[model samples]
Target: MIQRVIQFWRAINAHLSGSDFDFINIYLNKKEQNLFFAMRLYDQRHVLNVAYTARRLAQKDGGSINEKLLMKACLLHDVGRTAEDIFLFDKVFAVLLDKYLPKTAHKLAKYNNSRNRSFWKKRRHALFIYYHHAAIGAEKLQKIKLYDIAEIIKYHHAPPKYGDCRELIILRKADSLN
Candidate 1:
C-alpha cells in the first residue's frame, strides 16, 4: 500500500514535469517519434526511464543487442495504457479495487467502455488497460509491422516458457526498475 502511494506520487510528479526526450530523438525515426509523443506525459517519462535502464543493462551484459529495437520496445511497451485518459484518483481507486475486490474490479473494468458512462465507469476502463496494456500495446505495434518489438511487448509482463531473447529479459528488468 505504501509502495503504491509512493508510485502514485511519482507518477503525478512526472506528469507535472514533462520530459523533453531530446537525447533519444536522434535514435528514433519520424514514425517512432509520433508514437512516443502520443503517450501521456507521465507515461513518456516512465518510458524514457525504462529506456535508460535498458541501455545500462545492455552495456553491462556486453552481449550483441539491437540497441535500436530494444529502445523501440521500451518506448512502446506501455502505449496501450494511453487508450483511456485516466486521472490520478481513478488509477488509485483501480489499484485498491484490484488488490481487494478483484472480482468486482474485473467486472467494473470489463464494463467500463459502455457508451455515455459515468466518471467511475471511465475509471474502470483505465483499470482494464492497466491490467492488459502489454497485449494491447503489442497489437498496436503489430499494426506498425514491428513484429519483433511487438513480441517483446506481448511477453514483457509474463514471459513465455521458451524465452531465449536477452533483449526481452533486459526490457522486463528495466521496466521493473522504473
Candidate 2:
C-alpha cells in the first residue's frame, strides 16, 4: 500500500502537473486512490479531457449540445479499467462485455446521458450506466436510479444505431485523441 501510494503520487504528479489540484486532492481523499489507481486516473483524466473537448467542438459544429451525457460518457468510459488486473485483460474483457450484452450496454450509456438532467429532476439515469459495469455498478446505479448516467457508460463506447450518437461521437473523438 505504501509503495502504491508513492507510485500513485509520483505518477499523478508527473502526468497531471497542470490539473486542478484542489479537485484532485479532494478526489484522492474521497476515493483513497492507491498509487496504481491514481496513475490510471491520470490516464482517464486525459481521455475525458479530450472527450469533453470534442463535445465542445461538436457543439460548434451544430450537433446537439449535451454536456451531461458527454461528461457521463467521457468520465465513465474508463471506469471499467478498474476491473482489469492485467493490461491485456483490460481490452479483452471490454470486448467481451460489449459482445455478450450490447443492448444492456447501449441502454446503460443512455442512462448516463440523463445523470446531470436527473440531478434537477426525479428521473434517474442509473440503470443505463449500471448495466455495463458488470452487475456491480449497475445494481448500485439502479438503486440510485441514474439511468442516463448508466446508459452513457453502457453505450458511450458504442451508442445505439449506426450513424452515431452526438455524445458518442464526441466521446470517441475524445477517446481517440486523449
lDDT of each residue in 52-115, candidate 2, tens digit only: 5766677777856677556544554555434222232233333344578666545444333322
Candidate 1 positional error at 21, Å: 2.4
User: Mind giving the per-residue lDDT tens digits that candidate 1 earns over 1-178?
Assistant: 7768777777888842323456557566777667777777778788888888999999999999999888888888887776245556766788899899998887777535556777666787787877787888888788888898889899888954574588898898999878
Name the weakest run of 10 consecutive residues (lDDT summed) in model 2: 120-129
**Local lDDT at 43 for model 2:** 48
How many clashes would you count in candidate 1? 0
lDDT of 2 at 116: 37
TM-score per model over all chains: 0.85, 0.47
User: Judged by lDDT against the true structure, how good is candidate 1?
Assistant: 0.78
Off by over 4 Å in 2: 1-14, 17-39, 87-144, 159-164
lDDT of each: 0.78, 0.47
